[model samples]
Target: MTPMIEIDEVTKYFGTKLVLDRVSLTVNRHEVVCLIGASGSGKSTLLRCVNRLVAHDYGTIRLDGVPVDDPRFGKTGLQKRAGIVFQSYNLFPHMTVLENITLAPRRVHGVSRAEATARAQEVLARFGMDGFAQAYPEQLSGGQQQRVAIARALMTKPDVLLLDEITAALDPELVGEVLAIIRGLKDAGMTMMIVTHEMGFARDCADRVAFLSDGMILEEGPPDRIFGAPEQPRTRAFLDRIIASGRL
Candidate 1:
């Protein structure tokens, strides 16, 4: 099977500080990959580069059997082909949840308002936020807002989605709701790349886990190997500290 997303010897830098160093990986269609690492370990940066949000200084990214460097692969390709859910719920405060989703489909895809609204309604229903369509961002809890963000991304019907520490900002009670939404997506076979600290979720959801540190992937394998039987000393030590600190 062809990989849905591929990263080859990718490197990125900020001035003299190298953030990602010759990192590479492949995510197959209908597969979920969970990326875990310390803060500033380039997990999020790597995801951003895949969709051309960061624009890597070296290496290449391919999406859906097409090289990302092709000039034809511009914002339209990035927006429609690859969806991204941010750590923060970047919803528009003024727009209602319904409008938040319809805006993209209308403007980007040129779908009629009625058609977009119909699609938005279906996805929001699936996301369990159907009734909240008319509600403004401020009217919803952080979890609700995040779900709306996810729904909006899915509204475009992307082939692959990137999630960046999506539950880090929510209250513990709220976190479950957001995670449940993601779990639903995983079960529904959305190809996903997740940078997450939620180990249990990763263990349960990911087909594979990549352990990143110092701008490189230290190890990667099925969750059983990475989470239950880590090979690298660094990976084991990191997991130990995380567990000891009561974060996992």
Candidate 2:
């Protein structure tokens, strides 16, 4: 079967500084793949590349084996296939939760307002934000805003979801609520590529965990092996640091 997303020898550089060096990975349908590494390890950059939020300097990225940058795909088409939620909630401050969630579908996809609203209501209800549809961003906590952001992404009914440090901005107490929604998505078989610093969460949620070091994926395997018995020295060193920080 064709992979849902494929990255082949993708290289990216920020001026003289190289951020990604011949990196490659594949994400299959209904599979949850987690990218685990320290900050500046290029995990987040890889996620951005997959969603076309940023472009790679070399190599090709494919969605279901079709080139991601193909002119025919267009920007809107690429976004529709892959939905991404960032660490910071990017909702418009003036828009209510319902309006925020329905904006893309109504404007980009050309769905009628009534239909977009119904779809928003359905996803918001599913994600336990039904009561807050009319609430403004200021009225909700960080966790609630992040949840709304995730709901808005799902409104597009994307084929793949990319989550980048989604719980990073939340207070410790608020983290679980956001994580629970993600857990629910995994249970529902949402094909996802997640870049996260939470080792325990990565172990629990990932079908496969990839250890990236110095802009390359040094090792990848089932979470059990990657966590319990990493083969590469770099992978083990990274995990050692996580354990030392009491984050594992």
lDDT of each: 0.91, 0.92
> C-alpha displacement of 212 in model 1, angstroms?
0.7
Name the candidate that leads on TM-score: 2
Please give the range of 10 consecutive residues that has the lowest summed lDDT in model 1. 70-79
Per-residue accuracy of model 1 over 1-248 as CA lDDT, tens digit each? 66999999999998999999999999999999999999999999999998888889998888987877677876677768889999898888889999888998899788999999999999999978899999999999889889998998898889999999999988888988988888888899999999999988898889999999999999999998898889899999999998998877
What is the C-alpha lDDT profile of model 2 across 1-248, one tens digit per residue? 45899999999998988999999899999999999987999999999998778999999999988889998777599998899999999999999999998999989989999999999999999988999999999999999999999999999899999999999999999999998999999999899999998889999989999999889999999999999999999899989999999999
Segments in model 1 whose C-alpha atoms lie over 4 Å from true places: none
Stretches of candidate 2 off by over 4 Å are none
Estimate the TM-score of every prediction: 0.97, 0.98
